[model samples]
Structures are given as C-alpha cells and as structure tokens.
Target: MGEYNMMITEFPPGYRFMPTDVELIEHYLTKKVHCQLPFSSLSPLFQHIDANEFYNISPDNLVKNMCVDGGEQYFFIHGDKYFGGERGKSRVVGNGIGYWRCLGEEISIYNSEGDVIGLRVNLKYFSESSSKNNWTMQKYRLTCEYDTSDTEIEEWILGRITKGKRNDYSNYF
Candidate 1:
C-alpha cells in the first residue's frame, strides 16, 4: 500500500466527496432507479461492486478503485436480496471468508413532505478466524414504492462501507 492516496478525477485539490444518506438515496439511487438512463450513464460516480469482494483486496487497490480522497469509505449500489425485506431490510453480510453483522441502528428516512422514503441500517464486518470486528457498512433501502412488474424494490438498494473502529483503549488520561 502507498503511504498516500490519490484521486483520478479533476475535482481540484482537497475536494472531499462525502455523501450523506439522504443524498445517497434521494440524489443517486432514486435517479438511477427512476431515470433508467443509458448504459454509459448508468454507472454511478461512486462505482458499484460486490461488498464481499471489497475486503479481499488490499487498501491501496481499494483506494485506487474508489478514486476518492474525502474519506476512507466507499459507496456502491449492490443488489443482494438477502439485504432487503420487512420494514428493516434483511442482509447477507457474509461470504466464504468472513461476514458483516448489523449493529441494529436502523433509521427511517423522510422527505421534506414527511414521507417515509427508505431505511438506513449499519453493520460491522467480523472475521471468522480472528474473531475480530474491523470494518463498517451502512445500507439504505428504498421502500417498495418503485417496484416493477418483474423486479422487487429490494434489488436496488445502496450501501456504504469503511474501515471500522476498534475499542482499543487510548483514553483514560
């Protein structure tokens, strides 16, 4: 891994591109779901990939793929049925190597008209062998308002993942 990070965009220096839950669902996901833009335009600026595959790679490679320097986290539009259902979406956070467990912090998303648009949930990645938690993820699912004849709403949810915090004690001065 390199000692520093670099972004491949022309957004000037030190321009952090951090997006919020509302911006994610409303601005990005909603547009992607409703607009049905051309294939060339369909790719999100944040890029979409399987979350499980994320941890398998090295940090520098992840940083290169992410192409952002605002934060250590990256976002994606993952389509896994296991992560959506009920008022709170169900999720499959594990692959053959490890898994991500939810911390149970589900928040309701509301628009300006006070309409419930979606739900936001948080999760932490746990290593089976080390038995340690070291990564974090936040998922947002749009309610079934945009369901199609052949597809369910759960198939188009968005997720954001980042390195997690360890409870290592550096406090107690």
Candidate 2:
C-alpha cells in the first residue's frame, strides 16, 4: 500500500474525528442526521468540520451551515443534488442519500502523477430523516476525493479518529 496524506482544508469551524464508521454514524444518528459517505472519509470530515470556530455548536448546526451560503466548497465529499442560488447550484449524489454543491471556485489537489488527485463538491443534503416526526433532521453533503487503488484516505480518517479518542481520554484521566 502506498502512503498518502488525507488532509482537508475547507470546512466549518469545530469538527472532530471518530474511530469507526459506527461511531461516526452514531454521532450523526443521535443528532437525527444521516451520513452517506464512506466511513473512512466521514470520520476525518467530522474531525475538521469546524476547526476554526470558538463557540459550542451542535453537529446539526454545523451541517446546516454547510448548506448555507458559501459553505459548499468547504466539504471534502460532494452530494448529488443541486441547490440553486445566485452563485450557482448544489447537487445530491451517493444513491440520493448524499449531496454536493459548488463553492464558486474550483480548487485542485494533485496526485503523485501530478494528475488532479482530488475533486471538490459543494454541500448538499438528504431528504430522509432519522426520525418520523422531527422536521429538524436535515442532512448535509460532503466534499471528498478518493483513489480506488490507495487506502490513504481511509487511514487519514482513522488517524483523526485516533486523535479525537486520545483527546477525549485525556479529559477523563
């Protein structure tokens, strides 16, 4: 396996990582949200969702902002549906469960071959809700790029989860 770095640059303000897809899913599930990206990417996406914010916020709020104005390019994975706006529109991808919107400008990430290794999608959301009556349960899209031949993206996500666990552990001990 080739060693690769899975670093993300554009996101909300206070994201954190989880160790497993289950953990990542559980976190969003409890918030009444559904995540559609691969568990590997989801973990790190959450880790850095809000790395620049200073206030305590809910994951849902963070997710909401991802869909608001100018929040599209911040995602690592893109959704499939397109939300129309003055800048452009957003689209939802991933079996109609995820979304991706354009953030107005396209940024490129290159691979070892100097080929564009990563693609960006604006934020989008799903229509299904984890709860039957909760209208507040809205889904947010992600922006991500992956290499079918490499596992660096997954490992990078796992690293974020590990770091989060360590931080959580330190607080209790």
Candidate 3:
C-alpha cells in the first residue's frame, strides 16, 4: 500500500462558520477551552479559529489573518484584564495603542431550557483621539457561579469582530 496523509486541509468551498450566540458559546468556545473538541484529524482547520493573541495586534492586522464569514470574524481569545484608573476598577481593554470600551451591559445567553449558559458583551474600539473606529467586538464567555462579580476570572472567551457597523440582534429570536 502506498503511504498517504489523511487529514482535512480545508473546509468545503462556500462553507460558512456562522454560528448563533448560543452555539458559539456552548459549542465551539466551550469545547476549545476544555480541549474537548474531537479535532485530532482536523486540527489544521480548527487551529485557525484560535486567536489567543487577539489583544496583541491591531484589529486591522487581525482581520488580515482570519477567515471572515459574512463580514464577521470569529475567534477564541483568552480573557485578560488590567486594573483601570480608580480603585477596584478593571477593564477588558485590548490593543497597545487604542482601547476598547464596553458599549453596554453584558447580555445573558440562555439555552433552550431557559438556563443561562453564557454571557455576551459588546465592545467598541476607540483611538487615542477618542474617535470610535469601525471595528466592533462581541465577546461571549461561559456562565459560572461568580458571574455577578466584576472580579471574576475568565479563562477563555469567544469573540466576534465586525469591521463595519454593528449588527443588531434584537430579532435573533
């Protein structure tokens, strides 16, 4: 028998990775963080979804290396925090030059069984001049017991970045 390499090099043409909020959190994000994804034979394609250093580079640069789907790029990033100005304040800002600010309160993600499975927060990036950039991000983290506290430690988070205007999810139901 001739030697052969059995591996999935790419997804089918025109295949999209668009997953709903719940699926992003409960399936991909959770599985990636827990190392439970059965991707031994598909690690190459699966590895592209990991954006561990998402905060280390500019959004524009990050986009260049991502597989964008419908103008939305999804990746798995480690949740890191720094103490912001003022006492006991911490922020999830990224990028060395610009800063990301929370656009609104974190939204709760519920499964079909009415259980809160995860949380999603929207963020907008602002330059040094305080001008809002076209880049926007939606970060989803798995739900835990300490979700009510701001000091809770998050391990892995799933992020969706869009270059243009933010998409409204009011009709996601």
List the global CA lDDT of all models: 0.56, 0.31, 0.63
lDDT of 2 by residue, 12-86 (tens): 676533222233223442222222345464443443332223013323444553433222212222222332322
Q: Tens digit of lDDT per residue, candidate 3, span 1-173?
A: 33476554677985555678888878787776566666564343333443436555667777786544337776656554421222222243354466667776678899999999988888766666446578777878776654434443336666778877645555854
> Model 2, poorest ten-residue lDDT window?
156-165
Work out the TM-score per prediction: 0.63, 0.24, 0.65
Evaluation by TM-score, superior candidate among 1 and 2: 1
Best by the TM-score measure: 3
Top model number, lDDT: 3
Whole-model lDDT, candidate 2? 0.31
Candidate 2 TM-score, true structure as reference? 0.24
Listed per model in order, the count of residue pairs whose N, CA or C atoms clash below 3 Å is 2, 29, 0
What's the CA error at residue 163 for candidate 2, in Å? 20
Q: What C-alpha lDDT does candidate 3 achieve relative to the native structure?
A: 0.63
Question: What order do you get sorting by lDDT, best first?
Answer: 3, 1, 2
